[model samples]
Target chain A: MLIERKWKKWVFFYLPMAVFIVFTLFPFYWMAITAFRPDNELYATWRQPNAAPLWTLHPTLEHFVGLMKTTAFPTWLWNTMAIALVATGISLVCGMFAGYALARLKFRGSEFLGTAIFITYLVPQTLLFIPLADIVRDLQLGNTPWALMLTYPTFLIPFCTWLLMGYFKTIPKELEECARIDGATRFGAMVRIIFPVAIPGILSAGIFAFTLSWNEFIYALIFMSSADQKTVPVGVVSELIRGDIFFWGQLMMGALLGSVPVAIVYSFFVEYYVTGLTGSVKG
Target chain B: MAIVTIRDLNKKYENGFHAVKDVNLEIRDKEFMVLVGPSGCGKTTTLRMVAGLEEITSGEIRIGERVVNDLPPMDRDIAMVFQNYALYPHKTVFDNMAFGLQMRKYPKDEVLKRVRDAADILGIEALLERKPRQLSGGQRQRVAVGRAIVRHPQVFLFDEPLSNLDAKLRVQMRVELKRLHERLETTAIYVTHDQVEAMTLGTRVVVMKDGYVQQVGEPLVLYGQPANKFVAGFIGSPAMNFVDVSISGDGRHAETEGLRLNVPDRIRAHGGKRLTLGVRPEALRIANGSDEHGFATKVDVVEPLGNEILLNFRAGGAPMVARVDPGVRLKAHESVRFAVDPERLHFFDATSEAAL
Candidate 1:
């Protein structure tokens, strides 16, 4: 029976898990190899006898160095970092307050309001950018970081609110009631007890919001007009591709470098992020 | 240290569910008042209204001299211990205990002193530095109690505070809570669904059902003379056996399908009327030869509970249990004669269920 169970587990769990890992990680592997492969190896066709498409015989940092020096990669990186951080901060504050009110407060049509916020989240970003672009023009925020900074929260806030609201609901109402009876006002209880207890949820929300804004394509592409003003995603795609010719080597290097910050963030807070989504406050 | 007076308290929820209906209670100073009943009995609702956690639809609640009807919980100068302990998960035990005082802006020295004192009293001084999740259920319960007591508030509200503990821990905590009440002398309103907790810990117990107060008195008084059938059935373990019967024409006997017993003179005025007879399990005993009034029934089940053996049988078309000495040897389907204790018998009106 035990051996049979082990065989079943191998078929059901480990086999699928290995397939999923390879499928997801394959793109990153291709990107890394292309970024390091010497120019001759990168451009060589599979028909060539000397060509090694699967593994590179020679590796070099020429593409990374060339991309960094020839383009405004550092400026784009800084812009992405600053915008993602600021947008995440704004969305998190709004999300925390909105989530708390929706989850905890008793009011007329509060349920309707919560559903309405979620419905807004369901609205596709593809359809939203048109009206958002018009608003950006009216506000004179076009071609500026403010365009993306303010627009990112339009999607980010709803997501964070929905997520944090679920997290807040898992917390027992007794905690706040006890705090209130312990001489803390409603606001005080929220700030002192509810917010502190929700740190894991908050961090997870921040990480998600940061990633969303960092990799955001449509609004950043449309809003940012200058080479230096653009975020990493738009800057690399627009500047590296020079019409009908894909700069695979430099583009791959940009993709690899662009993802390092997000990777580092996930690694540092992976434990908290997992618990935030899956674990409720249990006494 | 406070007298809590709740007058004509009524709570109607938004969806038109009337949760608490006209609850009037005057908890005496330093009294340990327990509100107990089955679920949805309005016991916890009444307690929350007193704590200012629930809004009063219509009524007035006064803590000491102040009318606290419109006051928020923080302004009521009361502390509450929740059923789940509700200890802050991130804070140390010391910080949890000191929170109330810190909120009230007490000096740092005073907060430390009070926290230490409360931790000492709870015998949890060593756990002061640990978070709530690090402690056991009993230890977390102590910390919750410590949090409430450290405030030295005018009143303490407990919402089934020990319900989460295991059976053994519950009993120990019950004794500790009673002792703490005596020592602190703070008026407390505790809500629970457990009758045993109410009976053992309450200076006075209030029994509620279906959003109304059924009876309020000393535990033994409520047990001995329940205002109605509900209280009689609710207050005792194994519950009071209720059997329907009618008084005989002579005003001498009560008769039913399986029982014919002499009616006590005190309730003979209602002769010839249909009524319900209530008998405590302990009040029925295996009859001796000298006993003139008795009933014979076949034991359906025998539960030997160490100190006492419970014999389950059918009488008057209703199932009944007799609490007899453990030495009584009886088996299922065996014939037994039980004498009902006439003095302890209770009669209630068939329709209203009120004691006669």
Candidate 2:
């Protein structure tokens, strides 16, 4: 009787977990099946009796081949990688220093500056596109990747700095005081002690900055008007559609390919990324 | 070894709050001095001023022969072990101990040698490769001491380094620190709110209260000859008991509720009609018969502490405790006679609270 009751309790606990697994996993399973399905099989109607089985059909690599050939997918991937890497690099440097200053240093306007930086992060990027576009034009950066580089960091820096400021503050002040008394100048202490201790925070902020720049659509769409200058999002949306009739197979194929780099990045540093995102949420 | 002198040290916060006021002290070479008080008594502030960690509002601090009020902490050549242990969390114990030496640009062999020597002395040699998080609380504390030991600074500063440990470990570390001090022969200044730690570890203990130095002497000197009421109350466990009393008959005797006491001629020479009488818990004994200095009181509470029994009772409407022989069977709600040891009694001026 006791064993039976324990079995009943186990079932009760696992039912929701089983239901959630099916709910979230079904779509990804479907996407994988669709990605491998032949164009004929996908277009075939399922209304008729004795219809051909979707599972029994042979998979084709035609969409993948067509995606690579017809669109500027390779160039777009290269452009995205370059812009994201550079933007993430710039954001990390700015954010770490600003975060340390906000966390440890006492100055006249420190609190006000920290608040202002966080407020800037809350301001919508869409609101700044026009002003940023004008600045890009004034700087004669139209039809150039420099426009995206300049625009991406504006969104990334404030949020990264705010996120890291919270992480830096969690470190005990005594740790830094110990370093200062050990004959380190303030900057030396921060660089040697604080930065190493906050590596997980730094990586998390870097991933956010990278992915934000990688998947960014609006600024890339509005800023870079030329074909060679377009990032992955803008390039894919532009090249995959010619007016209304959609290139569903190739468009899906391009998206599948476009997502691989980020997926690989996520897979490699998934632990740090998850910790970083959760840490940012708490902040 | 170097002597540290702090002259007329004053520390005032921005809002006109004085945390330490006109403090003065001189620590000789190889002397182990403990600054002890209750919380917010400016003991830690005084130590920080000596270490150059806190700025002095006015006055001067000299280490050896050089004036150091304007110098930074790094230039002061003083190593501090914080209450929290403050070992670099990301670094291994070896790195934490070697940090100060590396910062001073000591040769690699010399840094390694000093770190190893400190680790050996602290009995943490095997834990050197571990991070601070991996070690126990005691081990982390030893690492913090090791960090300071490697510096071999002119003066060592410890701010309640044993307060984080359990009672047993605190006592154990107190003994170890004293032994280490003797072995190193370095001038050391320690701050603790625990009177036991201060009494056990310091060659000379400075008792402080309300931002002023109450007394400075050897542990027993402060215990036997407290300079003021605050010192009398602060320097002993269970604290000294006080009673309001008035003197008459040309100051030959003093009277309070429930009893009358003969005054010592030495105390009468100070010439005060009203005073506070201080008697340590051990100074009061169960009187065998009626004595001139004996008083009758009701035993309200009895706490047996193995070695001694703390008897809490009411005398003249004020609560008091007496440490008595444990074999003496005493119960609550019963009456007993207690005699104050005339020579051990301390007299303090009612207005100034100064010792008479």
Candidate 3:
């Protein structure tokens, strides 16, 4: 409001907005162009007379077809989907219960327990993986989908629990009290009233858990050394490049396609997701 | 219907702070008992303890001869309407009304019938399909009422349920709630900070302050005969006028600076003792000529409320408001004379604050 001039508005508002949009969108644009460019054009030096790194003169689905036909990319996609979904489901259930307990129940050490759960989320994945890899071998779960499926929850559960804990606190305690007065037991009231009212919070927690598990790298890479069990991130890096050579097109293509499921999940729950982040409940 | 009897009830928090002192009350069957207090008076704590939402520090609560000190809220068979209307966001009004029955394992048809019946009572049959968010604030309050009534519980509890509503809607809903209680004939304990709401809605009103019960009686009884100075002042709008006065001439009259008032015979026993005189705003009137009891004052301000006018004045060094006929015209800061009817005058011991 203070900046009344058109040029001043551009200097203060539109220019900064454009810079942020371009900064965020450039990576996706690069990924898209690289995914469609022919291999010869992708590999050509920028100095070559006909070479263009920013835009391709010709775009083709060759890399996508090659990714499907020549590599285990299809297998990788399936592994990522299955692992992400199960991990998200496991974490969401555990998060909802643990979160409700931490937020609503009155017991000794509940506050300490909540802080401990949040502390676990702050633990770096790199340090955690060292100890986790030992446990993974002790359980004899290495090189299987179960290795990552079970391990992803260690991090994802803490994240989901902390998120859901805050969300549950935003829900009024009166709802549960009213439910109890309405002849529902404590557990009954939680399930019937609290959980229903917390749908936005639950959906947002699920989306975050799904995205985190889908983009997971170190666990997928270390746990599954076998070709068929590898997820998209590991499968692309391991299988696409030969020694002293890079498969830039297929690498970009994998990253591009790998993000679609997470994108779709976000778009579907965008409304609930916003409120979940903002924690605004009407009535 | 059930009688809720609470004996020697007390509530002390985990931090060693006592919020409710020993309180004993018997809510008779079908009685609408209101606990009215200012903030921090523990009225809500008492109601919550009755609802089994708060643990009683030490007491016995009997609902129809069953000591429910350790019973859970669900087993207590009471329905509470919360201030925020606590409607499940994901459920339609129909589902919200039906949830309690479903949890109790009621038959499907019976659940539907109860929901429809309650909806009909609240005039929300058309809103059965809508979620709570789809309704306005007043409609949502009605839905909350519908949810509470659908179960036909033995007792009803209300915790400032109308405080969130607008003025007109609150008044309308207050009447509706009274009518609902009559039709249901269930014992209820209501807690509200608004004295007006308590006076209008309670069959018997319990006025509390600082975690202590100040007075309990019918509205007019509490109004006409307040037990203490606090009760006398707190129960009325614009507040009662209080001035320190000393007995004059055999204690038949009390005298303040430039004003003299006849004391009641009960208070005249302490002939030379200083006391506080209490007068309700409406009890003061414009003095006519030759009135012996008239006190002189300067009108400080005038508030012309359409039906009547209030004269704000200073008499005997205490600010006071007087409800006068709208036809009476007086300018602010103008000197005026006023008198109090002797019967309406209240006298209290200055140290004890107990009414005489």
Candidate 4:
């Protein structure tokens, strides 16, 4: 009877979870194997004697070596990291103030202003990049990391603001009022009491902003022309495919390495991210 | 330790909600003044305005000798405890208590001493290192109160600080709060919807309704000689039952749907007019057979509350509760009669609701 119960539990819970894991991991498995497979094996027809599309008989690190040594992959990585970090920092500061004002302050047009900000977020980036591209050229910032860094906030700020606004709303208004009555000014209350209490939410917004900017593509593709100036997404796509001749191994290697940073960020702050989204400020 | 004077204070929200209208109050030093009312009755709004948390739409508020109409909350020299406790969730009990001193630029040693003193007073010394989320509801409320006391402000404002606790804890905390008020002896303005809290904790109680101050006086005065039907009803448990009655043509009695009551002689000038007759549940008793001026009623329900029995009965076409001896074995649907204390009968102008 116990064994039957255990079997039923496995079928109901573990089986579906294992299937989902495999389904999600299959694409990464294909990417990593292709990155390691020798060029001959990778391109060999299925009819070849030793050809196996799913697995490689002899794996090599040549693509990884080539990606690092032959290309400006390091420079691109540094550029992407620097631009995403700076943009996220700028967006977080602005979003914190804007979110607090929209959520707490009773100013004229506050509701209208909050709606206006959310509307800006709903404007598709595919269309925004056109006017943004023109502005980038006008400022002579094309081919520079500044182009992406400055433009990323146009969308990231709105996203962060809305997220943080929702988070700020969950906190009881009496906390701030009590702080004020406890002898802190409004700004002081926000800095000492509210910000500290909202750290999880802030961290969540920061993570979201970082991940969004890290994986951003359209603006990076339009603005940066230099190999070293490009972000991970634009750099790998632009450099690995020359006139329709794809360097599949190098492409896959770049993709695999490029995603590791974001994955690391998610893993380290996953608890904070969940709490931030749920926004449990118990007082 | 300061007198708070509010003169002609009014509050009108931007969206055109008149939350408080023409409220005037003079709270003496070291007095515990409780503002009691139903929800949306402007009691909390009036307290918030004094704390400077809500902007005053008109009139003047003076704390001591200074008019604080334009002062920010930090400069108001008052602390408020909210219903939800409102402790800083991220801070430990010690830091939460010290935050006010630190913000006022108190020296480090002084901040520690004051916060520690407050912790000691509140008996939360061992919980100093624990965050608010780690504490129970009652403990968090203590920390919230401790945070307020550390500053030694001139006045303390409490906004229903015990409404969150369970029944047993609420009684315990209520007693503790009363004791704390006496020890501190600071002027406090408390707001609560619970009439029992107002009666027990307040030296003076102000009853408000619909943005208007209905009555303000000592708790017993508000209970025994309420200024209006609203205060008479709002200031008691098992609220004062009211029935519409017309003064009889004889000039010394009143009549309702199915009964007649001897109108107290003091209200004789109101003869031949419609009025509201108010009587508290405790002022009623089961009538013995020979009792005069007793009205017949049918027992609807019997709620035996250990010490006293609350007999629900239909009298004069209205449902009412009469507090009687618990030994009275009454059952539902039984016929009974109750006699009210003639002197305790309240007469109010039917149209204005003002006590006559």
Candidate 5:
């Protein structure tokens, strides 16, 4: 009876985890399989079991090789990297100072300002595309990375500032008070004391900003009229379709490559990313 | 060394709640002054005001003759140890101790020397390389003290610094703090709600209640001659017992429900009025059958410590506790005769609760 009960409990615990793994990971599995499949095998119908590739068929890197040479994939990758890095950098510098102020300092209308920033974040990027396109034209930033750089922080800063405010608040007020009493000025205390302790929160905010800027499509599509200036998201989608005949293999490859930098960034700061993102959810 | 003076210090919160009301205190140089009271008693508010953490509502604070009302905390040239230790979690112990000196832009070698010297004094030299999270609670406390010691500030403000430690470590740290204060010869203003900590560590204790200073004196003086019922009840461990009694004569003698006692000449002038009798637990003794001064009571509980026994009993329909030798074998429901030491007895005006 005890053995049966123990087995039942173990099964209950593992069931949801197993379901989640299969449900979420199946697409990536199919992508990997298609990425490695030869062009002839990729077209094989799965409806007839025997028509699909069997053990006898050899795998090929033809899609990956074709993906590299046939498109402006490298330039799109570089553009994505540059815009994401610069946007994340700008967001981080602005977010840290703004976050620290919101968390610690007493200033006039701070609550109103914080709420205003958060509300601004709730406004969808898609809704601002037309207005932002005109603004980009007015600023002469059209068909340039500057348009994307200028647009990304609009979404990033408010959320990032709110994220870091929650993180900074968790740090004991006494730690900063101790610094102040020890003859360190407010700025000195923040730099020497509070910032070091809040590194995980800052890292998560940086990753969030980077990922948002990298994956952004609406502004990039609307603002970048030239193909040379297109980011990976817009570039990949536009290039995949020519007169309604879709290139699935190359399109999937572009999608896969586009996600790699964010995945790598997530992996490097996965612990901090989880903590930092969850920290913002409460605020 | 510095004489710290606070004149009519007041802190009225934004919502118009007055936390500290016209508090005035003069702490002598090298004196370990302890500000003690229950929570929300304005003791901590006063300490923070002194440390420049809280802005003074309307008052002057002078540290060694320099009016510090308008100065920011960094400009006050004082060191503080927080109740939570407040060690920078990301920094090594050595860096934590050297932080103040570095902030003052002291040269690297001088900062290192002072940090090392403080670490040696606190016996934390071996743990200097470890982060705050790596150290034990007691070690962290010592590091907090070391952080202050390295500064060598004119005054040190400690806000319940040892309140976070375990009982044994708190007792140990209390002794270490006393010795440190003696060696440093700095004006130290410590705050705690623990009367034992206040009594043991304070050269002079300032007792506060409801944003008002009740009394300030040596520990024994406050214990023996409390200014009011609050101080009498607040100072002792079992707390001094209070019972309503009516004075019949010119305040020479008083009578209650099941007890009668002769009031001392000091209280004679306030006779023919209602009063409250205050007696410390240690002042009450098991009376011999022949003793003239005695009261009989039924024991409700008996708690035995290794060195002493605390007897909880009821006298005149009022709860009372008596501290006795551990060998005394009194049991619950047993009737016992006890005597209150006349010299240790305290009397307060019934209505005002102020000492008569």
Candidate 6:
């Protein structure tokens, strides 16, 4: 019976888990292998003898070196970093205040407003970019980093607000009330008590916003026209794959490098991110 | 000087729930006043209104001599301990206790001294550097209390502060809170649904039901001479037994199924009228044979508690329990006679359910 149970456990849990891990991670593994494979091997047909399509005998850094030397990858990385950071900061501040107000304050239309904000978040960015493009052009922000930095918050704010609002609700309201009675004003209580307690939620929201803005495509593509002003995702796709010909090695190299910052960010706050999403406050 | 007065207080939510109705109270300096009732009885709502945490629909609150109706909680010089303690999870015990003093911009050394002093009194001086999540429930309670006492506000508001603790810890904290009140002498208004806590902790207890004040008096006075049926039923443990009975034509005796007792002379005018009679469990005793005034009934269940025994049986066609001497042995379904003092009887008008 115990042996059967163990066998069942492997089939139901571990076997499926292994399949899922490979399924999700196989793309990244493929990217790394292709980026490191020599040009001759990468282009070689699988039908050729000793072609080794899956595994390469020879690995080289030529793709990474060539991509950096020939393209505006460095500028794209810097632009993505600067835009995502500013955009995340802006969204976090707005979301914190809006979320707190929606969660704690008792104003007329508060529930209606909460649902309305969430509805705005549900509106697809695909449809929003057209009208936003017109506005961005009218504001004379096109072809500059300001265009993406300002427009990224349009969706980022609502996402952050909804997440942080749910998080703030999980924090006991009594903490703020006790603070108010302990001599702090309403605003003071929010800043001192609610905000500090909500750091985990805020960090999670910020990380999400950073990742979203970092990997954002449509807005960065539409707003930034200059080679140096373009963000990583748009820059890589636009610059590397010219005409119908694809620079598979360079493209894969760019993909791998573009994700490192976000990976580091996620790793740094992974503990807080989990707790924030789960919305657990000790008191 | 720190007397807190509440006049004609009312709270009606936008959803049209009338939570508190024309409540009036005066909490004297150095007095421990408790507002108690079942859930939704407006006890916590009334306390929150006084704490400025809830908006009062119409009321005037005065702290000291000032009419503080428009004042914020901080300006009113009041502090509150919530049911969940509401300690800042990120802060150490010292910071939690010192938060109020620091907010008021007290000097650095003075804040430290006051926090240390309050922590010492609560016997939590050893745990000052730990976070609230690290402390036990009882320790967190002390820290919450310490936070309130460190400020020495004009009045302290406790919203069922001990309800979260286990029963044993609750009892321990109750005595400690009472002793703390005696030592500090700050006017306080505490809210709870537990009758025992109200009776033991409050110098004066206010009983509420359905958004109305049922009775406000000393715990024993509320117990002995309750203003109405609700007060009488709510103030005691095991509750006062109520039986519907009709008075006999002689203007002296009241009768019901399986029970007969004399109506006190003061309420004899209720003769020939259907009324409700109430008797507390402790008032009944096992009667010896040949006791003319005793009523005979079969015991349904005998619970022999160590110090006393509880006899459960049907009286007036309703289940009733009697507290009696543990020395007298009894068995379920066995015939027994029980006697009650005439003065211990309580009569209420059947229609109004008001004490007669």
Clashing pairs in 5: none
For candidate 3, report its TM-score: 0.96
Worst 10 residues of 3 chain A by lDDT: A1-10
Off by over 4 Å in 3: A1-11, A47-52
Q: Which stretches of candidate 4 lie above 4 Å from their native place?
A: A1-13, A47-52
User: Quality of candidate 5's docking, in CAPRI categories?
Assistant: medium
What TM-score does the A-chain of candidate 2 achieve?
Answer: 0.89
lDDT of 4 by residue, B1-356 (tens): 49999999999998899999999999999999999999999999999999998899999999999999999998989988989988888788898889888888899999999988988998999999998889999999899899888889899999999999998999999999999999999999999999999999999999999999998899999999999988998888898988888898766888978888887788887778888888899999888877798898888888999999998887777778998888899898999888876898998899898998
Give the top-scoring candidate (DockQ).
6
- Structural RMSD, model 4: 1.9
- What is each candidate's DockQ, to 2 decimals? 0.88, 0.48, 0.78, 0.84, 0.56, 0.90
* Better structure of 1 and 5 per lDDT: 1
Off by over 4 Å in 2: A1-13, A21-27, A48-57, A273-283, B269-272
Please state the CAPRI-style docking class of candidate 6. Answer: high
For model 4, the DockQ equals 0.84
Model 2, residue B30: distance off in Å is 0.9
Per-residue lDDT over A112-202 for candidate 5, one digit per residue giving the tens place of the 0 to 100 score: 9999999999888778787888899999999899998888888888978998998999888898899989887789889988888888899
**Interface RMSD, in order shown:** 0.8, 4.1, 1.2, 1.0, 4.4, 0.6
* Chain B: TM-scores of all predictions: 0.99, 0.97, 0.98, 0.98, 0.98, 0.98
Candidate 2 docks at the CAPRI level of acceptable
lDDT for B330 (candidate 2): 88
- The Cα local distance difference test for each model comes to 0.93, 0.86, 0.91, 0.91, 0.88, 0.92
Q: After superposition, how far is residue B331 of candidate 2 from its true place, in Å?
A: 1.8
Q: List the residue pairs that clash in candidate 2.
A: none
Of candidates 5 and 4, the better by DockQ: 4
Name model 5 segments beyond 4 Å from true: A47-50, A53-57, A277-283
In candidate 6, position B316 carries an lDDT of 84
Residue B16 displacement (Å), model 1: 0.8
A157-256: candidate 3 lDDT, tens digit per residue? 9898988889989999998888887778899888978887889999999999999999999999899998999999889999988896888888899999
